[model samples]
Target chain A: MSLDTRPPRQTPVRHVATPRERDEQRGLPTRSLLLALVLACITLMVVDRTSGEDSPVEPVRRVVGEVLGPAEAGVNAVLGPVLGLPEMLRTNDALREEIAAQDDEIAELRREAHQNPYDVARAEDLRALCAMATNTGYLLAPARFSGYSSAQSFSSTISIDAGADAGIRPDMTVVNGDGLVGRVLEVTSHTSTVLLIVDADSTVGGKLGESLESGFVDGRGGLADGDPLDLRLVDNTVLPEQGQQVVTWGSEGTGPYVAGIPIGEVSKVYEDIRAGTYRAVLEPYVDFTSLGDLAVVVPTGEDTRVIEPEACS
Target chain B: MRGNSRLVAALLIVVTALLVQVTVLPHLAWNGVVPDLVLLSVVGAALVTDPRFATLLGFGAGLLLDVAPPADHAAGRWALALLVVGYVVARLAHDYQAAQPGPQPASTPRPPYLLMLVAGAGGAFVGTSLFALTGLLLQDPAVGVGALLEVVLAAVAYDALVAAVAVPLVVWVFRREPAPRVAHVLR
Candidate 1:
């Protein structure tokens, strides 16, 4: 007994349950499922990015939109007025100045109304006639912004309640009381997505309000958070001064954005001597953050010659 | 195959949040920035759920958001970002719980607000920055770096503020049961 021939049987050391071990004990997540899902997402992204209006994901997207669009519309309609109250309360300096300007206009109107009532009324009638004549050149249909672009961080577009059902087609110009907001990107049956003028990819023919200098106004896509609109000058000889009003110069026909829609006011002018062009940063008239009622500009009638350029998907 | 009621409820909550985000958040935007409620919901769900479920939740929710109207980019950008966010959040919560050997006594403080903040900022940053990076990688430099910074800062700050309210609510709502002697702060 004192001299045991065999060494004591070694006791096995049990491994402590580490986190991974515990996790495994519970159950290992099926790796195939994760891989399949991830691959699916990536593939969808790549395909959708490449395929414009023809991705296989389009069906699924359409179905989701069809199922959810109406529900979103209903909720927005019911809660819109109530929710807009907060935004309505928050006013900026531009708004304050606008209010002041309106007050001055009202005062002038009041003075005119009191001093020469018949003359003012006659003048107003004449103005209304003139407006009707001017408006005859274009067909304008108003739509409300139903929802914003889903990815707020990167995208700048808004969905309108009106769409193909409302005679809306892609590439139509959208505007509000202020100025040019954007152009229609895509149109579903009852809803359409508008790519704003401030989107980086958007381009419109523009003219300076004062100098009449023409340029291709490109979007810096900063309208949402105050990134100014960029106007690429066609003429190297002219440089637009800051605060110079910018307006759309229409294409030959009913292009994406028609002519005469106010785009923005030049905020900064940078001349590229090599390129022989000046890029002007413009302060857009429309405050994109508070977009509500917008009108889509369509051709007066069925003259469908305005070709819709395919946007980068 | 995905018929868990909690998962359904979580998905419903996330979808509702996304709806509210697009509909009501614009009107509630301050300085052109709005909180990503869906991101917050992901953080909330991640805190209570496993990584697999959280990833799935993020992917599904993001796909819905991407395909929805007003989504200008590709269909799965948000999906990728949310997938990362959900996994990170679950890992954070899981690691923290695993690190704690035992539940503390009643006298000690249970400070979840700290974690809430980290989760919120991290999720917002990861989600948004990934979205922006995808744009850049696609050769679509829509906004300048300065503008992107503004958007990121605004989004991160706003989400952080909202997370205080959303994170605890989500965790409490989705959590199955409380560990014994571990008095949850979600109450």
Candidate 2:
């Protein structure tokens, strides 16, 4: 619609105009325009849904992420302290008390560390992650949490600072210090989207940590923050108890998820009467609400180290 | 000059709202749902702008929300949702204006708070429901019925609550422009 630039008049017109007359005179959005826009959107959605991995929408999304990722990070950095002001104030007194208590504890810990010093420099979370990596023998590239999916209510995903530039690719397993966070869904030059395990549509191969009873862990889509996941075991007769640890069963090539990463512990168990199936609830180890540092696992291909026979020599 | 200023103001408002929606609002979310700030901004703009402009604004904002990072759903879902929101809100405002008994003053009046509140709640209800419904139809493993109901209700309430402040801010930004109909009549 063209902008109508009316000259200022000497007096204001007092006549009331009908809605149709007003719309016509102003040349406002007509039915055709609205329909066309709606059609465009439908077409976009159709193309996006049917195209899967290589959708035309992927390039648009990647450019948007590359452009907006740093901007959002900058805004977050500026607003972080301001946003945390309330929590900081609430904990001020507790922090003061802890400072005094921590001094003594720090001194004791430092003395103990001095006696058996070996790689105590890493943060606690990173140390745990390193331990997990060593135990699993997978290559890990660390990433920082930057932003979250805008449709938080409907789906669950998070953007990290590391991406293709860091050798991160789609379907790589993402884990935190505690347990599995999710798998990489999309990757740009410097950012990637990780579909959290708490998302409604996510299903991971999980099994009982001890008994090795395998099941599928389904995410309940409502809450993005540590929502309870539903576990459906393959064996109907395996009556699982509460507090049993659940871990990933691992994928074939370890592209999606690696084996033995702690998922959560069973909180409740019930039997589906009609289906005659057993179900358990798992409370995840990772805290979704406060997700910060994460590590994306890149599996190293088959071990090629040559083994020499020392005893023969 | 007036058109340029209006365009810049609207752009600033929508971009800021979109930025905050993705960055900060997640932290302040209640019940795991953040208020739809972009929707509220479109509602605010619709109150003052022409219907054509409002519809376009809605489509653009929705498209941004759809393509922005971490949005795993289909690309056009939000674009469709917000397009409807903008059209509905603009037409409602136009009808309300037409129903008024006398000619409006030359100066643009403040946007009606009740209307904004209604638009916010209604727009949010429609937008989120449409987006979620489309997700389900696509077999995207959408939330259950109970969860969908909870989301729709929470989004409506939250958007309405935020509209109280956000709508006025947007209306204030667009206040410099002459009311579209009034300008058309004067010309």
Candidate 3:
């Protein structure tokens, strides 16, 4: 009826919705959503990269790590009993064997002491060396073994329980009964990581006992057939033979690692045609694989005088 | 039923795993390789929990691992990496379930869940690599890719083993209750 009076009124028709449109409506925005996601990702990467280098996170990590400490201690403690069951069965037999070995060793030492008093004097000297090294006012902090990397891709290293809180500093020397384990490379509040001498990047100044021949001991990663460790003699002048002892020269005046701490005995020496230097592999006196406890040598500045220029020469 | 209990349990599990890894595992190393028990526990927890809870758990577990021993990399890297892993795994699971949509018929068997296993193992690999990479970038260049891969593989194997056993237990523990049935009787 209205059409008779005027043109029919036009109403705007709404567009039909597609499934894709519905999906889009239900989901996040394309451009905005992508922008948000990209921002988040960038933030995360930045956080990760920064976190990798930042030291301030140490305390937070330490607190979180406390959760594992007791549990780990409990597990380790319980494992002792669990492992002891088998050892208990073999106790008597092991005791007998150990006693015999000790007796033989004692007899050999006694014979050496009687025949060559110098051997006894050398033993006394080593003991004195260890004592003097310990007394150098270097704050010795005890550390428990934490973890180790089995990957041949990196250097051989072990984590310790002590950290910066215990005054363990980076580049500080680590030693066991035998000699140098490595140096502290990183420190947290409650833990520290030691880079072992067997690591590919590890370098130390060492000398032979008989010839006073000096050279550098360099780590070659993934020793042939993974024979624990390999050390390259960087100098051709000093030829290290198998069974000769190697000790830190302490030329750097770092008394944490004393001059005569036994590092390892030369296991093998071979002349390299390509390098023209003798490649001598060392089996470290400290069996890193079985290391349970360690001592971190804190620089006290007291023993700085021990490694005088005259003595190092 | 309380959330705190679950948190405490998770904490306990992680701590125990760390201790075992450091102390006993060294003695039990096979050709210098030790099983990553902490990684295994983290993956198992992430698989069964919500994303937020998984992230929290992962962060906590990672922190414990970072602190437990020879400190290599800086703190929080592991925590951050694990949080992401937990979130990713949870999201993937949600997407998978949403796609499948429906209760199984009585005659139907469950589908193979190998993808979830792979994801878990892959997460562990990523976590370890990030740890090594972070350490190298920050402190020393000695962290080698070969060694990082070895750790990743070891962690994956260990995580897989734990998942194989722990997944069923987790499923049983956290299984949802069936909806109530309404019966219509025809007289």
Best by TM-score: 2
lDDT of 1 by residue, A1-313 (tens): 4877976769866779887667654333356766777788788888988987888888888888888889889888999688667767866987899999999999998987787966664444334323422443455565777988755566678899888877788988887656788889899988999998777788888999888888988777654466457787777778789889988898655568788888889888888889776777888888788766666777656443221212111
**Candidate 3 lDDT for residue A127:** 50
Q: What does chain B score (TM) in every candidate? A: 0.84, 0.88, 0.72
Question: Which of candidates 1 and 2 reaches a greater lDDT?
Answer: 2
Locate the minimum summed-lDDT window of 10 residues in model 2 chain B: B1-10
Among residues 3 or more apart in sequence or in different chains, the pairs in candidate 1 whose N, CA or C atoms overlap within 3 Å are none
Candidate 1 residues lying further than 4 Å off, grouped into runs, are: A1-34, A84-108, A114-313, B1-3, B103-111, B176-187
Name the TM-score of candidate 3.
0.40
DockQ for every model, please: 0.31, 0.49, 0.10
Candidate with top DockQ is: 2
TM-score of chain B for predicted candidate 2: 0.88
lDDT of 3 by residue, A85-203 (tens): 87667677789999999999999988877978655555443453345355443345667678986785466778999887777778878876456788888999999888887777888
Q: Which stretches of candidate 3 lie over 4 Å from their true place?
A: A1-54, A61-75, A91-313, B1-5, B67-72, B99-120, B136-141, B161-163, B166-187
B52-161 per-residue lDDT for model 2 (tens digits): 78888899989988888868889889899888888888888877876888987654467677887887788888888888888888766457878888888888889888
Question: Any residue pairs clashing in model 3, and if so which?
Answer: A68-B15, A72-B19, A153-B147, A159-B70, A160-B70, A192-B71
Candidate 3 global lDDT:
0.62
How does model 2 fare in lDDT?
A: 0.82
Show the colliding residue pairs in model 2.
Answer: A29-B52
Best by lDDT: 2
Off by over 4 Å in 2: A1-22, A87-93, A99-313, B177-187
